[model samples]
Target: MNTAQLKQEIIEYSKKIGIDKIGFTTADPFIEMKNRLIRQQELQYQSGFEEKDIEKRVNPALLLDEPRSIIAIALAYPSKMTNRTISKKGERRGIFCRASWGIDYHHILRDRLHLLEEFIKEKVPHAKCKSMVDTGELVDRAVAERAGIGWSGKNCSIITPEFGSYVYLGEMITTIPFEPDTPMEDRCGTCNKCVDACPTGALVQGGQLDSNRCIAFLTQTKGFLPDEFREKLGNRIYGCDSCQTACPVNKGMDFHFHEEMEPDPEIVKPLLRSLLQISNREFKEKFGPLSGSWRGKKPIQRNAIIALTHFKDETAVDELIQVMNSDSRPVIRGTAAWALGKIGGEAANLALEKAQQVEKDEEVLNEIDKGLSFFCKDEVGQ
Candidate 1:
């Protein structure tokens, strides 16, 4: 079979395997992507990965290590039943943004891509292919845009008419070249909803994101979250989706019927009271199957405490006190103290006093004192 026929067969097979969109492009866009990465690094927006590693991330040659074409696939992850709006009632909300509300897309997309790769190898006999679901060196979004799968929205996500920016991307690098798809035109004309909706100003400009200010990055980050970022985190115990939620194109997408993508009921909008009690073993058991669990429980638990603090729901005081005593992680204990302060009353004051007696870390002790002072002010006034 000629390369043209093989490409058609592959595209057909991709749709059959459940990928919503598929496109092919030469591994050349990495050149421009590399320059973009350099600019991002210079702006101090690149985090998690080292700036030196930007070359590897942007260089398609490094992705294949040999000449090849890229097969970019996008999976739509919209939800129909879920409301994107922040609840006015202040009920402990389950805030899984449209994209992350289900089974990990990385797993789903990678499995399907592997099937596509195997099919290609069977047809071509000598075809060499590498499949990646957000796990490789290639700029999957850039390749998707170049291949006409979708346009890059101002939110820095690929936007499709059917899925908006609520789609996950995967790529297959192959030695067998195919006719490339034409790139799409940008459609985000005069709309700044995503930028304006961002609570932390993570979107520096159209199609640009500062990871340092991004709540999604902050929630997944290792170590202590800075005080400023912590306060801005609000009730987001995991990834932030304010930008995608505000995108106009995401309207009317069906999220309820996507059973494969439905979040575990317990995880969909975890109760802050229950979250503060998660043991390390429980954390692993609950989140082991989740893509977000890669960072471990510390960050999630810390964020949970922060959320509890933000909610300032007095009912959670006893639970926060329990965490203060039982939780060993300094960050958790510290955050619990902070929560207690936010919920300050007689119960909170007593809990902070008890925590201060047992707390050994200076930071934790200071947090306890800070929490106590909230109620102490009332006592002085009385």
Candidate 2:
């Protein structure tokens, strides 16, 4: 078959496999993206990259490891799934971003790509193919845009007219050359709601994302969170969608009905009280199949405590005290102390004294004292 016919067939088969959009490109623009990465590294924005690897990202030959056409695919995720309201009560809710709410997209898309690869190999016996779904060094977004899938929005997400920014991207790199699609026009004009709505100002100018202040990265990081960013984290225990939520293009899209992507019932709008009680075994069981489980439960449980502190729900004092006194995780204990201080009252003060008496971690002890001061009266009663 001719390149045009092959491209058309691939697009048709991709749609049949449940992908929403498909397009093709030469994979040459990856060089420019590599240059951009080099600049980012030079500017000290990225760490642990040798200059050679950065150059490789821009070379199409290096991306595919062979000269071939590229196929870019996009899958629409339900927008309604992202709007679930989590409760501050002790019940605890799991908050999975709509993109990651259901089964892992990597497996789904890779399976389809394998089918396509088999089809191509049958047609051209000597053809070679490789596929990736956000797991490679190549810039998928740049290739997707070049292939006419959609334009990059101001929030650094691809925006398709039919699905807005609620789409997941994947690609197949093949030795068989195919006709490429025409690039799409930019639809986001003069709208800065996404930038304005970012709680940590992660979206600097236009499409640039500062990973340092990104709540998504912060929540996913494995260690103790910096205090400054914790306060701004709000109630998010997983990924933060404030930028996507504020996009005008995504407005009015119902994401709640996508049952496949629903948050695990145990974690759906979980209460701070119950989140504090998650054992390591329970943490593995509850979040193991989900994306946020990569960092284990400590970071998420700690985030829950921060959110509870922000809520200032005095009713959570007992749970916070329990966490502060008995939780083995220092980050959780420290955050619990902070939350108790925020919810200061007679009960909280009493808990703080008890926590301080037995706390071995100096950091946690300091947090207990801080909580105590908020509730304890001065001798002068001023």
Query: Model 1, range 284-336, lDDT digits (tens) per residue?
Result: 77767677777887888888777766767777778788888888777888878
For 1-382, candidate 2 gives per-residue lDDT tens digits of 5877777777777666666788888856565666667666666655232234665555667656666788888877776634455464544344656666665667667776888788778778887777887756667788888889889888888888877888778888788878778999997888889999989888877787777778887887756677679789877788888888899888876544334455554554456566779788987776676656677887888888777767777777888888787787777787788778777777877777877887898877777776677665542466
Best by TM-score: 1
The local distance difference test score of model 1 is 0.78
Can you tell me which runs of candidate 2 are displaced by over 4 Å? Answer: 46-52, 82-94, 255-259, 262-268, 369-382
Stretches of candidate 1 off by over 4 Å are 49-52, 80-94, 255-258, 376-382
Candidate lDDT values, in order: 0.78, 0.73
Q: Pull out the clashing pairs in model 1.
A: 79-254, 79-255, 80-254, 80-255, 80-256, 94-269, 102-261
Q: Which ten residues in a row have the lowest lDDT in candidate 2?
A: 43-52
Model 2 TM-score is 0.88
Query: By TM-score, how accurate is candidate 1?
Result: 0.91
Please count the clashing residue pairs in each candidate, in the order shown: 7, 17
